[model samples]
Target: MSLSAFLSARYGRGFRDRAQIEAHHARAFALFRQRVMPRSPFYRDLAQVPLAALPRMSKARLMENFSAINTCGIRYDQALDVALRAEESRDFSPMIGKVAVGLSTGTSGQRGLFLSTPRERALWAAIMLGRFWPSLARRQRVAFFMRADNALYRRLSNPLVRFQFFDMLTPWQDHLSRLEALDPTVVIAPARILGQLALAGPRIAPQRLISVAETLLPEDRAAITAAFGVPVDEVYQATEGVLAMTCRAGSLHLNEGWLRVERDVIDPATGAFCPIIHDFTRESLPILNYRLDDVLVPDPAPCPCGCASLRIARIEGREDDMLWWPGRAGLRLVPADAIRTMIACLPLRLRDWRAIQRGNVLEIWLDGAEGDAERPLRDALADLGRRLDCTPPELRLHAGLPPEPDAKRRRVRVLPA
Candidate 1:
């Protein structure tokens, strides 16, 4: 079944244009309405309504209406209980009957309960393994680093695959020996963790390194690639589902075959938009017109892979984290990439850097920065502000790096004072 799901996802959709993708969505949604929507008490009545007419769903809204939304008749409170219990015990084996219940990491304001049936889990594992599998002849060892384990991911373990889960709560330094001992052929972790592992110089030379959960920055990719002698690949997945993955050409492409993506543009200049997704592949929970807070910058240039799916240039941080500087006409967004470029051009060789905006203040932290490095950075930012027709945030320069977060590592952030 896993192999069949893999073959279908990898080769079934020979989508070559926008029309083909839309036609696919039409057929998928038709089947979904006929087979899946009637099962869901919440969506049963709204089955006939146009997709655009459906209410936009957020994490909070979904959790609030969880009992009615799911086809499995799982109550919100009951599901949360199961999810929380597994989180506390660190044993993800428990499930609400045949459905796997897991809690989202809650980066998007509220924690969410995600459900997957046996089939859903199989399809997920198949797509991942089929697309990113290094080789089929050899039994591959996979070291998966995650904040919490879910039975959904456990499906990847079979006779041909050795799957090892590393709990993120454990000290990373302590895992080094076990990691070296395992000698995994594929190492998967959050981007920052992968970057640190690259620097740690572990003996394991993985053929493939996949970055998940967190945004992969330019520096992180460069370091990981240099150390491992393999280009860093990415899997942009959320509790929502697998949204996108890196193609063989090393470009990030949306999984348009499994879902329909609608863009809500936030930064027109950069073509940066928050994605509104309708995933027909999810039967346990129907995710229609689900608006994610993540900002994605689209690449207009065509990918060499010729898949014709939308290629993503980068995943900008959350909408809340987008830096908005005061301008004469209105608030102007300061792209995180711009800040990185400004710092990169600086005379000082920075070991590390972080930019944080709070109200009218921008705090800049630099490792290996001396007092002399401040003036040049300040000048560069001022120049940028002028170019953007905005007032530069009051600069607060610090000489040392900020303490890294235990969860996802965001190099740049914006928040209230």
Candidate 2:
């Protein structure tokens, strides 16, 4: 493992200001240009170009040119074959030589393929182990829950750390017994599954509970904390990499050390923006000037934990989850947070709810409601529309919640127009 990176992450100096952050980015990008970009056939010729001048990347575009974009020269078709085969066989281990191949789906169900090398995996292990290993003095058991296991995580298995992967493809109820058997010190899973585990009241008392893969709503966090009696921590990650993590102050801090983040602000009032990332540490697949679909609201105040890194108020879900309504200026953005808050503030205690915009209608589903919710909810939407200076989509109410998918939970969604 990368002991130096581990030690540095745990006990190294942090940027106190923007100037220092820029300086670090300069040095990191320089190294990436000299060492990593030259290996990628797609980027080798453009190594000297400014990062912003380079072409942008997305999951679809990356998949289309995967053969040329990757430094390792692995063909997209071959990698897809291996990944599909592994999924079919229910095998979590799939690799190409020393590289691990992983398949991920976007919020809109778009397919994505990623590769991680041995050194990269080691560096990842170092950072995670250093930051959240619980205690070095005693052996720690870690239970990781995900749809598939990548070697990047499996590398953490050793004498001091008993790492187990709980495949989400199987029935989670069945895994509860196994989870109790381990009684892990650290539990990691999507926010929904974590909530499920909490409701099950697993006898295992974990020291740390990490929510990943899905958006962690305030309700989910409350449920988890009430069950575990510990503050719920979050890891805001995508297939791209570990974009952000919770600091000691319990705020989400951008991982400014590994990459440079440029904002594409959509709302100046809230300072809500889509992040454009330039990752220097990823050598296997060059991610330069890449735009992600996730929205983030920046926290201007410095973190009390002494981390000078950029802090975020919340992850506003994906662009697809945002509701758009008719406005004088055109379509106005109705963020997922607004919809969630509206539902939360209502007098009715809803066990579950979802808001989906389709065509000219906004479909709302409510669970465990005692009285008429349609009128109050419709009024709330009208009020929200008035605030935004837009017309809310037509409201359609349903009695029960939507069917649960086998993937991440989405409480708000805006279907394609």
Whole-model lDDT values for every prediction:
0.88, 0.87
**Which of the numbered candidates is closest to the native, going by highest lDDT?**
1
- Itemize residue pairs with steric clashes in candidate 2: none
**TM match of model 1 to true structure:** 0.96
Q: Measured by TM-score, how close is model 2 to the native structure?
A: 0.96
Q: What is the lDDT of residue 392 in candidate 1?
A: 92
Off by over 4 Å in 2: 328-330, 404-406
How far off is residue 372 in model 1, in Å? 2.2
Clash-forming residue pairs, model 1? none
